[model samples]
Target: MVTRIAKCTCGQLQIVVEGEPLGVGVCHCFACQSRTGSVFAALAAFSPDYRVSGRATDYIRTGDQGARFRFRFCPVCGSNLYHTEEGEEHRSVAVAVGAFADPDFPPPQDSVYDCRRHRWVKLPDGVTVYEKDPE
Candidate 1:
């Protein structure tokens, strides 16, 4: 089993994920853009086979689709570590890819909410693009 660690910028909160990610993707939705303070947000979803250390603050957000997500971020540095869907029996935790800080990490295979993607931004070839969230 391959283990990888993802931590907040201040090293306050950390997550250790076992095995490979279930899915790696980028979201161009406005909510993601605002949450990451970047044009888009890159994330990797992994199963519950992960562990977390240190305390984190939680912020619950309701998505465009009305799905609620509980964002867990470092209370000190305020770096978002991961988020999980609520009330859906969701078993996957989506971690911010940037927190991994590995340039060699796997590239994103899916791009969602492409309709809001910046025109100047180009995605890797062969990525599955969705104009909006796939319901």
Candidate 2:
């Protein structure tokens, strides 16, 4: 599979993702809302080998499993890049789907942490929905 790249608005940060994402989804969960200051967050899952260029800052958050997930983004424009499990061993990343420069990016396959999804908001039909983070 061919790798695709996504870059920050200022081109300061670029991420080269290997192949397609494992999944993509919108998270209406409160955590996402608070973090993004929006109703929902769109995410694209990728491999940990995802290569990122440009300086980034990390904000570690304790996930539902108590494992710290490090969110990395460009320090310049604050463009959210990817989230990862701490330690250099994990093999996956969840990229911010909105970061894609391509206007034709694929849609999400599932919605997670829906138990905390905003009641006023509604996801579209046909995608998998999970009350909590899907295992």
Candidate 3:
């Protein structure tokens, strides 16, 4: 039952996610890269009921699969907060790894969209890599 906490740069926004993450991974979609301003976006997915605190602004966007997803962020400091999506089997949210209050969070278990991965980024060996979502 490990709990993870995430906060904004000003500490004005905070959220507590109970239990270990459902999964951890990196997304190399162009949208993720652009929003994170990096090679890819690291994410920790959690169950839908995870407690969320502070005020967050949510923006909706359609993923490559055409499913609707929401991105939450701190309105003031613009810190990326989390993401949520609904589907047939899973309803969950993904917290930005960089927003974690702890710096020792584990690295991702997989790297998705390797075809889109930046030329300069090197992924660790043996990680499950995907050119895109399997489905």
Candidate 4:
């Protein structure tokens, strides 16, 4: 089994996950761009089988479709760490790929909200593209 660890900037919060991720993707929705302060947000989804350590502060926001996601960030450095959808907090999690700071982390395999993707941003070849999230 493979294990990977992601930590916040201040090292005040961490996540440990064993095994490969369910998916790795980039989101270009306006909300995601705003949340990440980047053109897109990269994240890796994992099964419920993971562990979290240290303290974090959470913020919940409702997506345009009404689904709510709770984002947890390190209180010490304000680094966004992870998030989970409402009612799925214990069944799944999405961690920020940048939080890992691993050059070897798997590349994004999917792209969501491509309708909002910046024209200057080019996705890697072979990526599964979606104009919007899959329903």
Give the number of the best model, judged by lDDT. Answer: 1
Residue 77 local lDDT, model 2: 85
State candidate 3's TM-score: 0.90
Model 3 lDDT at residue 40: 91
Q: List the residue pairs that clash in candidate 1.
A: none
**Model 2 Cα lDDT, one tens digit per residue, 26-102:** 88767778777688889888877778888888898887767787888788987777788787437678877777867
In terms of TM-score, the best-performing candidate is 1
Cα lDDT, model 2, residue 14 = 84
* C-alpha TM-score for every candidate: 0.96, 0.86, 0.90, 0.95
Q: Per model, state how many residue pairs clash.
A: 0, 1, 0, 0
Q: Which stretches of candidate 3 lie over 4 Å from their true place?
A: 87-90
RMSD of 2: 1.9
Off by over 4 Å in 4: none
Give the Cα lDDT of each candidate: 0.93, 0.80, 0.83, 0.92
Which model, 3 or 4, shows the larger lDDT? Answer: 4
Of candidate 2, the 10-residue stretch with the lowest lDDT total is 82-91
Candidate 2: stretches off by over 4 Å: 87-89
Model 1 lDDT on a 0 to 1 scale: 0.93
Q: Candidate 2, TM-score vs. the true structure? A: 0.86
Q: Where does the lowest 10-residue lDDT sum fall in candidate 3?
A: 83-92
Q: Candidate 2: global Cα-lDDT? A: 0.80
The lDDT ranking, best first, is 1, 4, 3, 2
